[model samples]
Target: MRKLLYLTGLFILYSMQSMAQANDYVQIQAGSYQLGDTASLANPKRTVYIESFWISKFELTNAEFEKFVQATSYKTLAERYHNAMVFEPGLAEFRWLQDSTAYWRFPNGVSRGGIEAKMDHPVTCISYKDVLAYCRWADCRLPSFDEWEVAARAGSEGYYFEGFSKENMSEYANVWHGRDHLKADYSDGYLYTSPVGKFKPSPWGLFDIFGNVFEFCTGKLHGDGDRYVAHARGGSWWCSKNSCSAFNTVYIGSVRPNASFSNLGFRVVKKAFTPGDKDF
Candidate 1:
């Protein structure tokens, strides 16, 4: 009876610790900013107002996701579908291929011998539904498109938060440095995805806001007969300046809510607590 009580106490303590750690967030003050790129006709720039909220400082990591999985026994979309899109380094133009056994646990797919996921790396191969499940479990929600763009810009007005120069990009993000799609320049010391926060943070101290992986947002497409398609921001390691300059603050990508890609992931946000509210 004593042993059972002791184990129950330990479990409660661990649960409390996990809850505290998962709720960590950085405060973003209320502000108005441009939502889209001024250069692109498809998605022209527009003014938007965002309320003050708490956003995660870094992308959701494999270690953090593991806790949720363990707690809820939640299986990601990649696992449920029994396949995931993976990057094929040998291909020149179109490099993404679907592998039957790929999941978040094995990001590179089963053919590559199922490499273990890095704990610090951002969790990938997750669908919008999967992100929703995670947010629900974590007591948070995915950031909206306007909020995401505002945070990525970090009060800067440029193509990138830092600038458009190659040197600035190399210092701030992880993107393809060479012209060839198959070969990365490795100037950033990462060929595929680097661990979250591997590069310098934005002015708001947000990491991996521009690159590392395409982060899903809460926005959906409407008007033009397209609805329920989810929004994604930032670029990935596979993106190049010439081909897909998705690293810019104004770029917004869309995907089906059920579609899960290797380069796609998400962060979370919550309303800022008041002085009298209970701590999250």
Candidate 2:
């Protein structure tokens, strides 16, 4: 039987445990969008057609992920590996470092309050597989590359997503800038991750789509598909104009599904199925 469901006041289907505390889901209309840009080698320009789907307005929050953890007692890849990953911007290059205690609880591996303090913050230190586990528990799945970009663009067009240029990016998304790449700038008021929806949302009503954390999508880079089955969308707070600008709309990155990182996280997507399909 097909039944109607209400999520965040939007008529949706499949009201499940995942939608309990995180009821905010945005419905993106089916349409075509231009993908990629001239700035990066990883992204090639093309037009993509997308089907209508539902996605969270904001990145998945710690409180939401916590609910999944409490119910399933699931151990994330970081937990299984007994280590968590962090992005480090060195003098000339950037890298990811692992710390035994730097799981989702303590993104830096030393913070005391952890998620308890910032329940509304987007959850980090999670792997693509860990995301799959949450999707299974919630009866949802990660957005595909096309779906993610289509939704991330959210009907915006330009050199950048919604707000372009380096000066005003802080107003649109949580990114690292306002100074040089080699210098630390907290003018945005966040050293690490900020609470979701802290900045302006996209025109079509998606928050933190450009930056916050690189969201995992089920798309693979054809060049590196042998090792990576998933690609990351949006730049993270670690991104700057001169450094790691994958935050740029056209930028698509590959990450191992089994590897989790401190600056990496994911969001959920619900398919708009045929009229008679089982509800969620």
Please report, in order, the local distance difference test score of every candidate based on alpha carbons: 0.78, 0.76
The TM-score measured for candidate 2 stands at 0.83
Candidate 1, residues 7-32, lDDT tens digits: the string is: 88877776766556444667788878
Q: Estimate each model's TM-score.
A: 0.85, 0.83
Q: Model 2: per-residue lDDT, tens digit, 1-280?
A: 1333334433333344335533477887777788776665766778888888888888988988998899889999888896677754443446666777788988767643466778888999988889988889888888987788877776665556555556778888898873444555686898678999999887767888888899988866768845646678898988888778877677787777777787898888876433223322
| Worst ten in a row by lDDT for model 1 | 271-280
Over 4 Å off, model 1: 1-24, 113-117, 222-226, 273-280
Clash-forming residue pairs, model 2: 235-247
